[model samples]
Target chain A: MRVLGVDPGLTRCGIGVVDGQPGRPISLVDVFVVRTPPTDDIGARLLGVERELERMLATHRPDAVAVERVFSQHNVRTVMGTAQAGAVAIVAAARHGIPVALHTPSEVKAAVTGSGRADKDQVGVMVTRLLRLDAMPKPADAADALALAICHLWRGAANARLSAAAAKVPVSRLPKGSAQKGWR
Target chain B: MRVLGVDPGLTRCGIGVVDGQPGRPISLVDVFVVRTPPTDDIGARLLGVERELERMLATHRPDAVAVERVFSQHNVRTVMGTAQAGAVAIVAAARHGIPVALHTPSEVKAAVTGSGRADKDQVGVMVTRLLRLDAMPKPADAADALALAICHLWRGAANARLSAAAAKVPVSRLPKGSAQKGWR
Candidate 1:
C-alpha cells in the first residue's frame, strides 16, 4: 500500500510518499515541503496548507495518510500551530476517503530506529538506510515525515488486519469489555 | 456587516449569525450547534466540523466570520480539541473569502455584558435582550454563540474600519513612529 505522511507545521509542512506494506522494503515515491508566509493571516495560512495537502493527495493517490499527532509542548504557540496544521491534514485526507493514521513522535522514532527516544539525526540515518536512498532527506521535517509514513506502514497494516478480524467476530461471541471511552 | 460567530468545541460547536454594524441594532439571523460523536475517529470528527461550518457559511453568506480564540487551559486534551475545532471554522471562512476575526472569551463576555468576568447566566440574559428573543437560547453553548456574534458586531466592525484606515495610509505618508512590535 502507498502512504502519504505529513509532518504538519504552520510555516513548513513536510510531505512524503512511500509505497510498501509491513515487513516489506518501502520505496520513497516523493517528498516535499509546503511553506506558507509567516506574515500571512492564520486563516490564510491554514487554507494554504489544506489546499497543498489536497493537491498532494490528488496527485499521489496514496491509499492511506499518516500524520504526526500533535503533542503538548512547553511552547503553547508552537503546539497550537502544529495541532492546527495536523488538523488540516486530517481533514484533507478524510475528505478524499483516505484512511488517516496518527503516530506519536516517539512511536515514529521507535518504528524507524528501534529506539523510542531516537534523535533526529538517528531517525534520518535509519530512514535513509531503510529506504535505500543515496542521501538523507533534507530539512529534518522531511525526514520526520518519511519516518511517520514508514511507521504507519509497519503499524497501520497490522492494525487493519486486527480490525478486520475483530469485525468478523459476531456480537454474540464478542468478549465482555468496557465501553470505549476517550476523546478522539 | 453580517457576521457569523462560532464557539468552537469538538463535541458541540456553537454557531450564530447576526446582521448589523457598529452602533446599529443587530438582528439575530440564526443560531445552532454542530455536534460530532466522541467515539468517531478524530479525522472524521474534524471533517464533520469543517462540513457543517461550510454549510453554515453558504447559508448565511456572512460578510465576515468570528470565532472564539482558544486559550491555553490546564487540560491539554480539551485545549487541543478546541483549537482544532477553531481551526476548522477559520479555514471554512477563509475558503469562502470571508474575513475572519478571533475574539477572546473575556472580550466576548465584556462586549455582551458590562464586565469581562460576567458569569454565563449574565451573558445569556444579555444575549437574549440584545437579540430580542422571547427566551434565552437553549443550551449554554447556543447562548454563548449568540453572545459571540453580538460581540463581533460591536467590536469587529470598529476593528475593520481601523484596519482599512491603516491600509490606506501609504508607508511614505505614515507618521514617523515606533516600528510595529507587539501582538494585537
Candidate 2:
C-alpha cells in the first residue's frame, strides 16, 4: 500500500509519499517541504500549512498517512508549533477518508535503522538506500518524512497480517507453537 | 464587533460568540461545546473538532475569532492536544476570513475579574455578571470561552484605536500628557 508521511513543524513541514508493501522494495513518489512565514499572523500561518497539506493529500491519494508524533520533552518553544502542524496534517488525511498512523521519532528510526537511538544521519542513509535515490532528500525534514512512510509500510503491514491470522484461529484449537509464528 | 472565542481541549472544545463594541454591553449570541470521543483515532478527533468549528464560523459569521493560547509549561501530556485543538480553531477562523486574536489565560482572567490569577470559579462568576445572565454558563470551558471573547472585545478595540490614532498623529506634535492618554 502507498503511504504518505509528514514531519510537521512551524517553520517547515516535510511531506513525502512512498509506494510499497510488506516484504517488497519501497520507491519514493515525492518529497517536499511547506514553509510558513513567521511574520504572518499565527492563524494565517497555521492556515497556510493546512492548505498545503490538503493539496498534498489530493495530489498523492495515498492509502494511508503517517505522521511523526510530537513529544514535549525537547525544544519547549517549538513543541506547540510542531503539535499544531501535525494536527492539521492528521485532519487533512481524515477528511480524505485515509487512515492515519502516528510514529514517534524514535519509532521511525528504530523501524528503519534497527536502532531507536540512531541519529538523523543514520536514518537518512537508510532511507536513501531503501528508496535507491541518487542523493539524500534535502532538509532533514523531508528525509525524515520518507523514513516515517517506510516505517508505516512495514509495521502496518505486519500488524495487519497478525490480526488476520488471529481472526482465523481460535487460541485453544491452535497447533503448538503456531501462535509465535503467527505473531512473528 | 462580533467575536467568537474558543477554549480548546481534547475532550471538549468550547465555542462562544458575543456581540459588542468597545466599552459597551456585551451580549452572548451562542455558546456550546464540541465533544470528541477519546476512543476515536487522533486524526478523526481533530477532524471532528474542525468540522464543528466550521459550522460555528458559518453560523455566527463573526468579525473575529479569539482562542486561548496554549502553553507547554503546564499539563505536559494534555498540552499537545490543547495546542492542536486551538490550532484548528485558528485555522478555521482564518479560512472564514475572520481575524484571529489570542489571549493567555491570565489575560482573560484579568480582563474579566481585574485579576490575572483569578480561579475558574471567579472567572465564571464575572462572566455571568458581565453578560447579565441569571445563571452562569454551564461547564467551566464554556464560561472561559465567553471570557476570552470579552477580553478580545476590550483589548482588540483598544489596539485598533491606538493604531488609528498613531496613523493620524505626528509623534512630535503630541503633548507629553496626551501621549500617555493616547496609549492608555
Which candidate comes out best when scored by lDDT?
2
lDDT of each: 0.85, 0.86
Best by DockQ: 1
Cα-based lDDT at residue B13, candidate 1? 90
Q: Write the residue-wise lDDT of candidate 2 on A1-184 in tens digits.
A: 8999999987899999999977779999999898887767777778888888888888989999999888788777688888888888888888899998888898899999999999999999999999999998989999999999999999898888887988887888766866431100
Candidate 2 ranges with C-alpha deviation above 4 Å: A165-184, B164-184
Residues B39-103, candidate 1: write the lDDT tens digits: 89887899988888888888989988888877565577888788888888888888899988888
lDDT of 1 at B126: 94
Q: What does the lDDT read for residue A109 in candidate 1?
A: 98
